[model samples]
Target: MLYEKLLAPLLFRLDAETAHNGALGLLRRANSRPWLQALLAGRDRAPEPRLEQTLCGMRFRNPIGLAAGFDKNGIAAPALAALGFGFITVGSVTPRDGQPGNPRPRLFRDVPNRALWNRLGFNNRGADTLAGVLERQPGLPVPLGISLGKALQTPIDDAFGDYAYSLEKLHPYADFFEICISSPNTLNLRELQEGSRLDNLLTGLVKKADDLARSAGMARRKPLWPKFAPDMPPILRDIALTKCRELLDPAIDAVVMGNTTIDPAFNPDPAKGGYSGPPLFPKARDQVRGAAARLEGRLPLVGNGGIFDGGDAYTMMKESGCPLVQLHSALPYRGPMIARRMVEELLQAMDRNGVRHVSEITISQPSRSSK
Candidate 1:
């Protein structure tokens, strides 16, 4: 109530990137003050078993995750986690040497339609610095997913070493890894999502992970999930899924069905960046639906893009078959209390839909589906 009525308006008055940095600074402050975080969270952070879900053998307290690119350097996870998210993904972080990313005025608000245009690219402090940051981060009640992207200077052919370097350095901090090859801002970045390239990247990553696990004497390596684009045409979508089917188990743990959409309808100047918000919901859902139908429940799916409320989350679960979903632009429209509200509303939605829990809404999953 207070956020929308008071704080959000003030934040909106700033430029998008400035507001974002200001928000992270606040979260960093909260991270230094546990009591303050709790006060802000109120009764919102408490767990609801009805929303509990299992991915692989791991349990998530809820389905709502703060999407990657929000906290690009793993700087605010502890405090963001305190805000009642099931998980927080830090970074679509690049390699050892970080890149400056795109120029100023890269992030814009499509406030009228409740959307954001971000061409910030993958700016970060590099994985080396992030590893140190995560080392000091206190453990949170929820899972933590880290996104890996190729270094800006790395050529397309050498992209493997760049991503592998990040994975190896940050492996210990991540509960699951999100290979981010779908961002529209990076030049030729989406090229990695193609069939042969996708196969090699995932295969090499799983192999590297296996070696790392063996060296540590751990039972299993961290889960690796590749993030895809929402606006992919049928043929391209199939190619990506085919690569996924080939790798599913020890190679790929799950799949993130989308990044943002570059559709001109969603943004005034599509080249500046893609859009994330309400208009992206149907596009993201439709893509997830098609992928689910094709994968036939072989691999679990994470849905990201324009998820604004509990109804959006519920529909993603029921119609699109996504058990896990991430929110980005909603924070602007709905305020910081969004997660708690979404959790409560999703529970109510489950009851109205006649399901006892989120996992029970398995209409899209096939007989083989478990996660």
Candidate 2:
């Protein structure tokens, strides 16, 4: 309540990126203290067993997760987990040897729409640093998904090597992996979503994942989920689905339906990057629904985008047929308590809809498909 009414407003007055860093810094500090953790935990609502879900071979205490791009370096994973998220996906970490990102003023707020636009360009401490962080941190209370991407200057042809390199470094640390082929800020990155390109990339990545798992003595690879864009054309989306079916190994677990939106309707500013928040909800739901239909339960989908409340979360679950859902923009607007609230709402929605399990609600309803 304090965050929504006061702290967030004051934070909003600052530059978006600056405020983001400040908030994260505070969370990191709070993470070091037992009392603060207890205090925050005390404020949270008791966990609801009905909200728990098992997806992609991992058990999520709740369906709600933190989307990628918030903790781009994996520095705050333990703290974010302590905040009551079922899971936390940190990083769109690049395989680059060094840290590189966009210039300042890369993030902007659309307050009325409760959205944000950013062209941060996969800024992080690089894959090696992220690996080290993961090694040093205490194991989280919930599952963790790591998002992978190519470096800014890496050519599209070389992007596969980049993604694979990051995977090699971070796979041991991730319960699931997200191949980010959809962020609009990277040059030609969206090409990975195209038919031939997507097929080639997944084929190579899947092979590498298998080799890594075998070498590590694991029975199989971790979940490999591709995070897509909401604005992908129907033909491109179809291509992506076909490629996922044909090229992805059985070890590949799910698809995260959406990274952010490149749609002009969401960002009228021609120069702005991908937009996210409430304005993105309807389109995101449509994409998830389409992917769910196309995949036909072959792969689980992680629904994300414009989820602001429990009703919004439930709508995404029912409409898209996604077993797991994630949140990002809402945290800033509603604070950590929002996670607890969302869980409550999701359970209530489940009861009202007569769905016995959260996974059952995903893609359960037939609607106008996007592709």
Candidate 3:
């Protein structure tokens, strides 16, 4: 209530990117003080044990996670985790150093829709700088995920090298890695999602991660997940699923559904930046349902896009069969407490539905002919 009634109005008045950076800066500073961290942590109680989940061999306190793009440079990760996300995804970091992103005015807000349109182009200080920061930061409250992406200057054919370099550099710090092949803002980046290209990329990166794990004396390869685009055609989504099921066991660990969309209908701009917010729920939900039905629980699905409240998260779990859900745009509009509120709502919905465990939530698959 405080955020929506007071903080949001004040924050919204600033230019979009400026507001975003300002909030992150405050958070980063706050996290440096013990009392501030304790105060923030005290606001939300722990989730009930029934919400506990183990996926890709890691135990998550709950299924709610902050999606990848929110903390793209690894700044303020522990502070973000203190907000109560079960896991925090930091970085869509590239191998190159200091990549300047798209021009200013790249971020626009659709106030009534509670949506964000952006073409920031994966701007970050690069993998080496992020690795240095991670080495010095305090232990996180939850699992930490690193999202690896191809460098903007890299050729389409040489994209794998960029991903491999970022992975190797950040491997020691990350609990898991999300191979980001789906962001719409990067040029020809989505082409990496093509069948053979995706396969080869995942296959090679998995090999690199395993080799690193062995040299570091770990038990198994670190978890590798792929983020997909919400705007994919049904056929492409199907192909992506088939490839994921065939690949998850050996080359991948889980799948995050999906990145922001490029649907032109959202605005009048010819640029059609990646769209994320309330309007994306329907499309994201359908993709989750379809992907879940296709995978048939073979690999876990982490649903992203358009989740503003606990009810939205519950629907994603029950109707779309996502075991875990992630939030991005909602954090800005609804505030940091969104994750705790979501878990609380999820538990209430579970009681109403007479379901006891997270695994018990599943929706019937629509007939194959519907595809």
TM-score of each: 0.95, 0.93, 0.94
Error of 1 at 113 (Å): 0.9
* Residue-wise C-alpha lDDT for candidate 1, range 1-371, written one tens digit per residue: 88878888898999989998998888888987978786666655556888887775467899998988989998889888888898888898998858888999899998888888889889999999999999998887788999999876788888889889998999888888899999998888899999778888989998998888888898988888889998788789877887887776722388888788897765567966988899888888888889878777777788888799998998887886677889888987786677888898898898887889777874323333332
Q: What is the C-alpha lDDT of each candidate?
A: 0.83, 0.80, 0.82
Model 2, range 263-329, lDDT digits (tens) per residue? 7876656376788889888888888888877877666678888898888888887876677788898
lDDT of 1 at 290: 90
**Candidate 3: where are CA atoms >4 Å away?**
38-42, 250-252, 265-272, 362-371
Overall local distance difference test of candidate 2: 0.80
TM-score, predicted candidate 1 vs. hidden true structure: 0.95
**Model 3 accuracy (lDDT, Cα):** 0.82
**What count of clashes does model 1 give?**
0
Error (Å) of candidate 2 at residue 253 is 1.0
List candidate 2 stretches off by more than 4 Å: 40-46, 249-252, 363-371
* lDDT per residue (tens digit) for residues 1-371 in model 3: 77788899999999989999998887787667756755544475755799887677777888889999788888899888877888999989998584877888888888889988889999899999999999999888688999998777889889889999999999889998998999988899999888889889988987898899999999898989899988888899889888877666622388888778887754335374888888888888988888887777677788988888888888988986777888899888987667777788888988888999887884222222212
Best by TM-score: 1
Which residue pairs does candidate 1 place in steric collision? none
